[model samples]
Target: MKSWRTMSICLLTLFLTILMGCSFSQESGEATGSSIILEFSEIETITDAGVQLAYDDVHEVKKIDNSFMVYKKTASDSHLYLGSVRDKQLTEYGFVGEETYIQDFTKNEESLFGRPMTLITGICGANCVENYLFEQVDGQPQLILKLSGHVLVADLNEDGEKEVVMMQGSPQIEIHVYKRIGDQIMKVNLNEEIGLTNSVTYNSQTNVFEMIINNETKQYRYDTDSDSLISL
Candidate 1:
């Protein structure tokens, strides 16, 4: 009886240890699986020498956690950049080494520039004061794309289910894709980029996508498979 009890206790401990190890592995995989590389152009109201007010549009790359890299130019006309240090440790998660890294700038700072800084970014361009998608109006997610924009309701991946594509939502001049989940309309940020043309058309015969964005740039396409944009 004593031997049987000891064996049972040992088995239980081993089983619990295996379960904990598997749980940790699953959590780590989730973080690695859906990690995205966010890239976009951001506008900053840069004040330069002689009291010059200029909007410097800089490209940026970052992670989902908001850690990022900003590109800049200085007075010496030399190239400059900023990013996290790889040799240093990350303060957020306390994981050894920084998950995010920055590259050092090689240019001299222009004294006249009012502290080259970031002014955050919008979904569209500077012309779009606010992105309706990011804002919650009247308790609903903003569906604000350009009023005269056309949406693509074609199947982009050749899959049975079609995807919704919209023209330049913001900083990047890439085609925007979207999927519908119930009543809300969501922007599919990252996907296979097909360039930044204002229009995209499908060819049933050739089975190729065509660019027809020259005229009537305001028109938006609705997905025929789900018809979510209209209801969106």
Candidate 2:
């Protein structure tokens, strides 16, 4: 019994140490005020040739910075591209399958992975709704997470960084939250007892996220230090 208890204690201590290490790394990154632009290099200006020109074909274009733009195409399907109007070149980034449409785009004031972060939503393949969190990772645009169902992107914890909240499964009651810490993106734990309703709303004034069903309403606030959600 003594031997088993000692082993269990050791394991618990090791686990706590690893978890604290991760938290320290994330806090360190935030403290330094990292820039997202450091993760990406300026696209090489290419001569007019075989490069697909998405600049003209896109339905809407949003500037990432002075050098790059995100273009959205809406038709029977929706597609998104990371392209340059000056270089006349573009690269398809997210939502490519069957019958997709871009639903919304939001920009985070703070950088994620040393590059500007974008939250995008779309419907793909037989009216399936999909949400994507994107940022430049190692000189390339990368999708941090792509999930199906209703989605929202906001700074849930009032931290400088925004979190991705997505609702999956039928009746849209299942809720999942994703937070970006340092170089990693993780899914945070949420209270399952407080079910979500048809409408999930955020009040910028209070910086609170709320879910309402029938007459019952639940509110949550993000705990930045712990990287978790707390009920308000």
Give the CA lDDT, 0 to 100, for residue 202 in model 1. Answer: 36
Name the TM-score of candidate 2: 0.44
lDDT of 1 by residue, 42-72 (tens): 2222232112112233323333223323333
lDDT of 2: 0.52
Worst 10-residue stretch by lDDT in candidate 1?
Answer: 90-99
On the 0 to 100 scale, the lDDT of residue 5 in model 1 is: 100
Local accuracy by lDDT, each model:
0.33, 0.52
lDDT of 1 at 208: 42
Candidate 2, residues 1-232: lDDT per residue as tens digits? Answer: 9999999999999999999999997754432222111121122232322245556577544565554455557643245554434555565544432323333433344354344766555555444565545666765545555566666656665556655666566534455666656665656323242332365555556866576534567565666665433556
Model 2 superposed RMSD (Cα) = 12.7
Q: Candidate 2's error at 220, in angstroms?
A: 2.9
Model 1 scores a TM of 0.25
Per-candidate clashes come to 13, 6
Best by lDDT: 2
